[model samples]
Target: MRELERYYRVLELEPGASLDEVNQAYKDLAFVWHPDRMPQDNQRLKDKAVSKLQQINEARDKLRSHKARLHVPSTRAASQSASNPTSQQTTTSKTTSRQAYSSQSRTPQEPSYQPPKPHPDLTGKDYSGANLTNRDFSGRNMSYANLKGANLSDTFMHKVNLFGADLSEANLFRANLLLADLREANLQSANLIGADLSGADLRGADLRGARVMIGDRVQVKLIGALLNGAIMPDGSIHE
Candidate 1:
């Protein structure tokens, strides 16, 4: 179990840590060690960060796959998600989950809940391979929307609500998504090259295997997004 031990060590977890713990540790460490957050002039640190990120990714992948075989208590979530795939797309009310509020990016004093927008109602809408480039959909609630393989390049989606939207393998290159609410969104393998997500909320969002960066140091998609508590492509969370 040398390899297993290495994985656990890389994620900073005790050996035989549960799936939840592994996932959580990966997120936490990713946030603290992402290359983009590092100083630009520190080439040595950047190189080290790159290496660390790679090890973290490998650890998460192996451990997750290993945990899948055990089907432990946490496997219930995976089973449930498989049974009701739409469950992953449910629009989680911020006020409803008190635990989420405890770790919110917003300051304890700020009270700007909004310009109340509509509840996300686009459940399971398929827009596969569609060219939706440059269309404006700011501030609209689109929770559970299925936009797999869609071309969203140059789209104006500032402050739009995309909670739990599925954009897997979608083309979001150069899209302008400033302040967009993308909480719990699925963007696995999406092409996010040149996408602008400055100040966007990305808590609990999945970005596995996405083309988000040009190099080890450059942040292509997450240039200015509010990544606090966001889950990255490598299963790490941004602080």
Candidate 2:
């Protein structure tokens, strides 16, 4: 039981979480700790990420196996019931009666479908390699969008929702990203020189190999930003 609890903690999940919750947590952690999102030159951080990923995978696998084992007895009982001719006859009779009752109570109705209206939510959009410099995207919901290798130099993205977005190798030079929701964003090797990230929520964001500093000084502004669990530009995990 202690071992199982440890697995749940590794995945940031509560004990006794359902299988669906386990799968979701696994996917979220895997994406955050993926080697491709880490700096290739930082061997120490890369190794750490690998180890973390291994732990996450093991936790997910063990929990899945445990859940499967728990359902084995129910499965066996279901198979046994299916093999019993009398049980199958009784189940068929009940199912047929229910179906007949449902059909009798059913009434035909006209379709009331309406076409979906367009919205500004840009979740999961692919804008790779696009030149979007000097654009204003304030307060926009662009979560999980693919902006890899895009040129966003000098863009205004204040309060934009970039959660889980892939900005790897993108050019964000001098961009205004104040108060942006950038949690879990992959910013590996992205150019953040002269960018204003003050008040941004960067929790769990991967900034490995990102250019946020010049010489011994950080060129980008990170004042008032939330950096908990975020990998810094130099591949150091923020405490």
lDDT of 1: 0.74
| Top-lDDT structure, candidate number | 2
Q: Considering only N, C-alpha and C atoms within 3 Å, which residue pairs clash in candidate 2? A: none
lDDT of 1 at 156: 69
Ten-residue segment with the worst summed lDDT in candidate 2?
106-115
Worst 10 residues of 1 by lDDT: 72-81
TM per candidate comes to 0.47, 0.51
Instruction: Please give the TM-score that candidate 2 achieves against the real structure.
Output: 0.51
Give lDDT tens digits, candidate 1, residues 74-137. 3344344345434345445423343343445244454433333665555566777889986667
lDDT of 2 by residue, 13-65 (tens): 99999998998787667656855445657898889999999999999999988
Model 2, runs deviating above 4 Å: 1-119
Number of clashes in every candidate structure? 4, 0
